[model samples]
Target: MDEWLDQLANTLATTTLREIHSVLKRAIRQAQARDMVLRNVAALVTSPTGTDGRPSKALTRQQAEAVLKAAEVSELHAYVVISLTTGVRTEEARALRWDHVVAWIPSLKTWHPVTEVGFKHRKFAIHVWRADREGGDTKTRKSRRTLELPKLAAQALRQHHTRQAVLKLKAGEAWQDHQLVFCTSVGTPLNASNVRRAFRKITKRAGLGTAWSPRELRHSFVSIMSDQGVPIETIADLVGHAGTSVTEAVYRHQLRPVITKGAHTMNTIFGDSHHG
Candidate 1:
């Protein structure tokens, strides 16, 4: 198996190798969960890092704006808004529950469920604590993070809440209460295919055609952040990678080696000495 795996490591691109490793690992974990295996031996193996593979596509800033504009009439509007702005994985977005949407109370200096407290002028955040994965954990420990919602996303969620309430009334007794942030009109959990089909429709409407995937929204997020001169390390944290190596390796093209945090920190400490 080691020799075969080594040969695969040599033959496959890095992204493909890592993805294969992940698939094998998750398969074993599920087997263990089902009591078919004693342990997840796949967890013991390190994911192979290889050279580049077929790189994924990301929407440019203009293209991303177009998608959002097109999503305005779609039920998936809030889903797309949050995914692109926060770089949340598709699974994470789908698994997001109402309880995790929180709002800060400046006067009380505490957080409350936005479902209960409602959105005001105060800051709001999403506790990225769960996913649709087995055992309901994020892909990695670092992937479990809290992020403040952008103003656009916050507004979308508020509007989405109103819209969902209307759906509940329309659904009547047929509605199921999974408390998911994103769900079907009948309140059933969303599957990948459903999201993909809806996303394609929105993309086609945006004049981007139907080939784009929902995951590309995440890639667009990383690209957009990198283009904004955010340090790779910060992008790594925001995207929930344990370190910057994956972010650097995966997004090398999107990261244009612009002014980094290193320069900003130095300038802050040195009073912009070079400018004089």
Candidate 2:
């Protein structure tokens, strides 16, 4: 096992190595429980550090804008818009259903005519309740959140819905409605490869390199919000992070150092009262 791992070390990444080790150990443990093996030899094996993998990157504001503009005319426009604007994970977006898309109706202090209430006056929102994981739950319990859509995201989704309806009519009997917001032409669920290929095409049209992925839209969302000085706690909640620690760790590059807020507040209060 060590020899085989050593041979793969040059090509595999550290995280991949750890995952392989974990799977092997679990299999061995299960076999032992069934009395198939006298001892779990895989448990004795430790995960070795492997080659470094590609580093994650977040897009700049200009790049994000370019991508959004390029994707505007593409079939995946709404998918890209929601991912970038809401900081939703790609898996969650893929599993999203039209039923989960809601419009927030604000309460009026005084009675208003029913005719005055319309979709135009409502704020669009999405409930992140499911993903491509087992049991159809989000990555974590905290990941199930409701996010108010920005203008661009709302517009994109509205347009996409109209387009999908047209396609549904065109398909006729072939249209299988799983209610997915994003899906194949026949209304089947889209695989990761399908999304990756479409994303790469969109990036290429936007004059971006081939290295970009759908996941980076979420990263761009984090970076842009952080750059705009949104609070870490708020960003965490928006991105469906269990805590600020995960948000900070995963998006360390996107986060601006917050150390100066205290100094600035102190300066405002003290105003250089003491001499040097």
Candidate 3:
């Protein structure tokens, strides 16, 4: 005989009230998109106290180590390695080619390649050499960034190249010329889903739980860098963020300690100890 929500809200716990409010808000937003609702009724309600809902969980360093160790013999190990170490997007790592590695001096350094891009050299390499390899567009103009590869990441790439060469020999003419760093048996671009499936298999076998995903690897990268006290601006630049503000907004929770540490550093630098 009475309004159901009014009856329920009168009897509902604070947490239940907040959740009901959230569900209604989402519904209203969807309805608003179709012009069925003029305003979000849930938005008008005051949120109940002390009910922020479930927190997101991320991998601890130990879990990451376990995953990487379990993935050791997999052909896709380099993908995990690059993701964990350098925060390179899965597509960018897959899209990488042998030519992307620039040798310092042609005759001297046989297998050694550096990734630091100088203005003149990048221009020359992009125009003359890298154009030959297919699959070159970065996700965004900002994503065309050059990051210094960690030592292990570079080593993994070297091993992957050798492995691919052997694969090419076995496949013979059947191997398509994808020039991709990661590929299927016949040298084709890997669909993102397939990689995730393989990744899940390895993680499950390793007992890492079903919660792990490729995006978690990227999140791990940000967390590790954040813990190391890397500046937000520098981290943003390394990770191809458009600006420090974006990085701060997205990673604010992860960077809280870094922010606190930065404040301390600034205070120490400007404090009376420095004023002779």
| lDDT for each residue of candidate 1 in 165-190, tens digit (9 for 90 to 100) | 99999999999999999999899999
lDDT of 2 by residue, 1-276 (tens): 988887778899999998888878888988999999999887777788899977779889999989999998789999999999999999889988887787665574332221243236447778886353434553655446888889888888878888988999999999998989899999999999989999999999889988999998988999999899899999998987778999999999888888888988889988987748
What tens-digit string does per-residue lDDT give for candidate 3 at 174-236? 999866668888999888888888888768867877656776676778887877767778888
lDDT of each: 0.87, 0.84, 0.67
Better of 1 and 3 by lDDT: 1
The candidate that achieves the highest lDDT relative to the unseen native structure: 1
* Structure candidate 1, residue pairs in collision: none
**lDDT for predicted candidate 1 compared with the true structure:** 0.87
Off by over 4 Å in 1: 1-54, 130-143, 258-276
Worst 10 residues of 1 by lDDT: 130-139
User: Which stretches in model 3 have alpha-carbon errors above 4 Å?
Assistant: 1-57, 106-143, 262-276
Residue 230 lDDT (model 3): 76
Kindly report which residue pairs in candidate 2 clash with one another. Answer: none
For each candidate, C-alpha RMSD in Å?
6.0, 4.4, 9.9
